[model samples]
Target chain A: MRYWLTSAFIFLLVTAFSQEPPSTGFLRHLMDREYYKEVVYLLEQTDYDDASLARKDSINYIKGWSLYSMKALQRSAGVLKSVSRESPYYLPAHFFAAYNHAHLGQYGTAGQTLDSLRLENSNMASLRAFENAGIALLQRDYKAFEDRFNQADTSYYPIKKASDKMLDFARDLESHRKKSPVVAGAMSAIVPGAGKIYAGQTGEGISAFLTAGGLGFVTWENYHKNGWKDVKTLLFGAVFAAFYGGNIYGTVVSVEITENEFQKAYDNKILFNLHIPLRNVFN
Target chain B: MFLTKVSGQPEALHRADSLFKEGAFFEASIAYERTVYLQPESKVVHRARYKKAVAYRHLHRYEDALRELDRLPLFSIADTLKSRILYETAFNHLLLDKPEEALWNFRRLEKTREEPLHSSMIPLKILILNHNRKWEEAKGTLLSLVDSMPLRPHKKQSWKDSIKSLYDEDSLPKNYSEEKAKNLSRFIPGAGHIYTGYPWEGAASFLLNGAAIGFGIHQLWYKYYFTAYITGFGIFYKSYFGGMKRAAHLAEIARHNEMKKFNDKCSAMMMRILK
Candidate 1:
């Protein structure tokens, strides 16, 4: 009797405050407030097994978008790719899913995602071409980039600037002079910091020059002043020799670092350009 | 009437709270958010939001808790609710290692009428103030709070004395300026190290630099200009710059040690009161 009464009282308390929330607008409202975590959580908890195809698409789109915003790219891609072609969310889903794949370095899959989409929308076709060009650029394949870029209709407003930027990358990469380690090392041996300068590190080259020059002078002075037998002369000579050798080694290492840094910076730009149009067109 | 017409204990607020109690904080956070949407009343919404932030805190997601807490309308909230929000915000900020934000929230909360809550937070506030190196402010706060306590006059005075002693100038950390140490070492190699309490190292540095300079002068006097310029000046150049950097580094370590010792003492003194 006591347990039942207590249960009844609890039921009454629950019913006293009970009100049905409008399901359709509630998720949208949570999304508007940027409560992405909540949006995902709510969707996960609610039973949507019997939801209509269109309804399912909308739910999946929302889930993917929330995951994307939270930077869960792999999960976002998986969820987004599930949105059916019949749904209004198809274009954005496919585009972002491709972007996520590309981001995760699944270049082949990303290209295939774009390639398989046979959109009649002229703008989407251009977007597809632009995205393909970006992928080629990331792979550093200039020829593929040029062919795909020419197919892209640059007149599409959302992708026009990005298209131009992609072309610039093509031009820049074609003329880019990657420094060779052997040439840099040879130059450093001849002129202490010349190799670093050729590696595009002017400041470092000048600093190296001074250090090496100073050490060379020290070695010369020690030999001239103390007949090359005094402890001071020997010590200075040894120190000077080490600095000279280290400078040449450092020049080679610096050239490699500069080249790698340049490649990374350009790749980041290519990725960023690819992302802009997706946001502009989808949003 | 509308709420009562349907079956809702906050549309699962009780369930959310139960989840929180069961240590299912992540799930509780989601459930709290569900309640926020399902429940129409602004008060219920606020309650749910606060509970969600608390759940996030339990999950050690202080940044998320702070984000959720920021959605609450501070000016429009009830005073008690406002006090709790401020208290929770301070706690989250402290947990996130943001002493400044935590201190600001604690000070704002002090303006409320919740005397017991404010009193309870005194030690923590002092701890934060001490962490930030605002020693005088912490000292004043502790002394004032002691004065306001209804303890016997003698006991109160003793407490005040104890608090004052904790903030004594003699007990404070030695403040070493890295810039000053660097500057001193630039003019005289190892002077900064001496100032930072490494006398033997400082002497060694001084000898090395002095010998280099002397060798350069001796070579110059002998009319071996190239030898003096290269061997003597080259050694001096490296030693001089290297000594300056080492001096600044030593000063940083010295200052860190002193501050740690001072903060440790402060923490120990406040431990009993805080507990």
Candidate 2:
């Protein structure tokens, strides 16, 4: 038995030494084929048993790229943050980082990242300008939005179309906000709900104007009676004051809500292709 | 069946072991299977079976490997070997997404050990319980385990530091009272933050509301009517209706969670007190 064990050990030792190491090319092949999720998992579980810089860099690059594909912006940012500036994958990492920041609505950070790459990435200038216009619109800086939109290159079909549509929508929203506030206030001053109608909130304007006017007439009539004197008159006065103030406030809120709703609808239509002509995934 | 007759079987088994060590897993499995059948009672045969299971796991044939593990009980295996099998079995279950079964086996393995349990097992137990969604129970277990861990050598400091973190998570205060905050904030701006023990935030909200109202009045006085109106509108809405709405939502969440926690704690306490 002892002699047999010795012979077997010797034979296995020889066989073990002859075995080749596993190939690293398999992961790259999978990635090139766009089996992205598979590559991501394999990269996540890549052996960190050896604490080498080259190994760490490869792992980090794979993670950053995979997360970019998955559209997990914040997590991708966290993984990509570890990559050094001098690495071969550095430029790609910066591009992804900027894209992620934009998706997160961190416009300033996204712009900053883009600015850093301007010397090398002149091709994205039009894209940057287009996105800048979007950020300006969100900030309610109409002047900045106009400036960015005008300067944006018309050669890029997507950005040009987006900017043109946004320019119209922004102007429409500004006009609506400016007009509704004045029109609704004047209508309320005249008949209450009529102001709501003028502001295009016809139902609310009519209700408010009618309620206030009716209440004002009732209180004036009641105060003229001999039985209910100072206290009842004072109570009616307070009610009148509240309705008067509330009518004004109500008109403003309605206009704001309407404008917001319109803008939200327009944005959804543009950003999510809600009203756009496109071949959808489900379709 | 004779002792001398069995000596020839070890040669084949050893050759299989060599093949396995060399990473030729498929060939090794076949050889090990033949050896085990040839000398079913030998310890060497049982060892070969264990190695076969390892080879299967490495090859990612987890289910097939786990089957061989289930067959090991019929053989007379050592306590240490049994522990390893149970551990590996539980790990396989985890890989298969059978966390509950893995937890059961892990617990069984824990119970079999004597004084001074392995530190690695504690964290593994906590993780398994966490996966099972027994968070509070897991927290309690970790706390007790941290307290009992040996504080001896320099190398053990890393373990101790980890245990300290366990204690911190377990002992964290449950102090988010949404109901109280909402109730307080409903009638007055910034009151919710105060009720929730966020005094600085409460103060800031009050100051902000006051400043907004003040700015609106100043704008109206200066004849910037549009600015004044918008600012005034924001102040009134935020202070009264918006504050009330936020408080009510926070209060509802707090009340529901607190009631659940109270009921669960009382039941658990009653069980302990009565027992």
Candidate 3:
């Protein structure tokens, strides 16, 4: 009779324990193993009120990091922003939040966040300077970037090297030729297709020259043969005038487009350089 | 052990079914997979596998869905259930763009059973045939299916008329012929482009060629034969002939694109019928 009672008790115990909800520790384990999908599922099913303060911070951090890895930048930023200042993970969470902001093209917000980090050591100061330089570069303030970069201590050789490379890149960008639409229009007015050639569009320049010159020649020949009274002469004259005016206008537009294209390409290169230093220093 | 297995199976199935009903296909598939692993030898296992396959399909993981269906033992399931599995297998193949494989499975089902689900297979078969450019067979199959539907004579005649119109559109004659296009431009430098519906290009070609020929003649009259032949006439003639050939090729391509448009429209209509 005692054996039967003990068996019943053990069975009930086993069943009760088996039905218990999954613990936060197991969720952390899944996160540590990089089972992100399972972490997401388990985290959604968990009640945060049951966890301790430290566990709650850990959960939020892991969830934010996982979402960042998944490229859900806005959600990651929101969750990381919730990490309280007293938590041990707060600094790293803030750092990632800055990066997420930068990735979303909010360079000003990213710079301010990095600036707000309390610099307790030389390493922190250097990191702040590096991120500040990145923001300056993205903002196209080369002078400000150089000032921040030169002030950063050179104890970290990688940071020193990255800063030096970026300074040279900024100098190269400053040296690149920039076109003016007004100048291009004036040049084309003097000679057909000259503005396009000045904007580095040689093929288009040649085509414009041929088109304008061909129409002008046809108009002149028609006027010479048929006199001013002929409708054919007037028609050719009007067509030639329209094409000549269009060539000058088109050259101005082409110059603006060329400048815009250069700016886009240069800006992308600067953004790439900015992100590279962050990745190198942080990783 | 047997009792434990029997008791555990329902819990897993119920959880999976709840997840499935909640539109959590990925999690439901995972849960159903776990249930299948727990009771691999039970008859309920087949149902679990089928639902898992369905979950994968909902997730747009057709290859995984087909993999699940492939593991199903057809001999162990009832005929009705087996036919449903076969239909799903064919549907997955169709989604994967493997129309030949889909058609083969669909035909297998047609030979074995005539269920309500099997009725949907006819439109899918027509789609496959049309996609493969087997228009005549698609038409025949469509007409037969329409005839089998319980509709009045006028409604059936309307369906026949729509199918005929689709067939005629698909088989419409090419508006431009390459041979005629090339010959027309050979006689008149820009005529071919105009024939092919490019009047601006025709004008450009005519003006450029006329200027070159006139310049060449004037140069020859002044006894500068080298400039006349080499610089003026030679390049002009080459461009003129090349433009003609290009216009002809473009016309042929345009005709092909029109036929493709018709085919795409028919395919969309057939898909609508399936839905």
CAPRI quality of model 2? incorrect
Clashing pairs in 3: none
Candidate 1 CAPRI assessment class? acceptable
Q: Who is ahead in DockQ, 2 or 3?
A: 3
Instruction: Tell me which of candidates 1 and 2 scores higher on lDDT.
Output: 1
Please write out the lDDT profile of model 3 over residues B1-275, one tens digit for every residue: 01123247788888889999999898887667657666768887888989989999999999989988999988778887788788888889978978788878877777667554345667767766754567788888877877777778997888788888887744643457788878888888788888877788877888888888887798578655554664468658877888788778867876657655766776676664444
Superposed model 1: Cα runs more than 4 Å off: A1-30, A33-57, A84-87, A118-123, A227-234, B1-41, B44-75, B88-107, B114-118, B129-170, B175-275
TM-score of chain B of each: 0.71, 0.47, 0.60
lDDT head-to-head 1 vs 3, winner: 1
Q: What lDDT does the true structure give each of the candidates?
A: 0.81, 0.60, 0.72
Q: Considering summed lDDT, which 10 consecutive residues are worst modelled in model 2 chain B?
A: B266-275
Q: Highest TM-score among the candidates is held by which one? A: 1
Error of 1 at B221 (Å): 4.9
User: Candidate 3: which stretches are off by over 4 Å?
Assistant: A1-53, A66-75, A86-88, A154-161, A227-230, A281-283, B1-16, B19-123, B135-275
Pairs in steric clash, model 1: A18-B7, A18-B8
